[model samples]
Structures are given as structure tokens and as C-alpha cells.
Target: MIKYLGRDDNGIRKVVLNLFLTGDKFTTGEVYDFLDKGNFEVSYRGVSAMVGLMNTRLGILSINVTGDHNVYSLKESYKNIVGSVLENY
Candidate 1:
């Protein structure tokens, strides 16, 4: 967790925004896998926990759960962040 948010919230949000900027469909588990491949060393369970926090506490991300898993996407203005850092955003 970075001291800015003091709760790892910003880091989690950044991860989500980065994935969404990839402009590809990703399931929760797949997203976890994608992030886990990175240098940050976070786990699938950790990603799941952050997703829950984003959904319930921050309300920055919206989700749709169907069949076997849930898909997560963000709300507005968060696009600003995605646009600044992403390639295809």
C-alpha cells in the first residue's frame, strides 16, 4: 500500500485501469493472472480482495457476475488516468 491512499487502494485502482486500457476482455481470474505476471508480486487472492474493496468501498469499479465468474469495469473520469498511461485507451 502506498502512503498516498494509505491503504493500497490507489495501487489496486491503477491495476484495474491498466487492464481496462488493454481493451481486451478479461475475467476476474484472468485479470488476476495478468497482474500476477507483473513485477509487483501480488496474488490472486490479493487481487480479489482489492476488487472487493473497489466495488464496495471506493465504488470506482462496476462488475457483472455471470455463470462462473465476474467481470470488472470502471466508471467515469477514471478514464483520465487510463488515457494518460495506456497505449490503446
Candidate 2:
């Protein structure tokens, strides 16, 4: 498991990870909007960067390019791990 999963950022990272629990694909903009609607005060770029890190560093999310935007989804293999981490977070 990634050490950074829920270790910092006032639990913002954990909230972001929980977003993937739905098993739906989302672009950065969509993620930002969801967070905003949920009262999470984070920049759109922050969400983008976090998602990027989950893709490149954490290696937990898979990406799909659609038109000009990148869509992200939790990798099937990491779903359980993510769930467990969140459960214990």
C-alpha cells in the first residue's frame, strides 16, 4: 500500500481516494466539481495533480484519454486495497 494514502492533507487525499470507490470514470474537472459540491475547498489543479500522482506514483488508477481530457478510474487490482485502506483510515 502507498504510505501517503491517508497520511496527510487533512484527509483530503482520503476523500479523493474514496471518490474512486464508485467505480466510475472521472476527469479532473468532474472530480473538482464533485469535491466542490461536497464542500471540499480544493483547487481544480490540486485535484488534477492528486489524480496525476495516483496514476503515475501510486500506480493505482488507470487513465483513458477521451477527446482532449483524461478520464481516470481505479485499477481493478487496487480496488480492494483502496477499500481496505479507506476502511482503516
* Best lDDT among the predictions, by candidate number: 2
lDDT tens per residue, model 1, 1-89:
12223444436556665676555545668878777676567778877887777667756566788888888776565656546644332
Q: How close is every model to the real structure, measured as TM-score? A: 0.63, 0.90
lDDT of each: 0.63, 0.86
Once fitted onto the true fold, the runs of candidate 1 whose alpha carbons sit more than 4 angstroms away are 1-6, 9-13, 21-25, 81-89
Superposition error at 62 for model 2 (Å): 0.4
TM-score of 1: 0.63
For candidate 1, what's the RMSD? Answer: 4.8
TM-score of 2: 0.90
Clash totals, every prediction: 0, 0
Clashing pairs in 2: none
Model 2, span 1-89: residue lDDT tens: 45896366577788788888775999999989988998988898888998999899989999999899999999999999899988886
Best TM-score among the predictions, by candidate number = 2
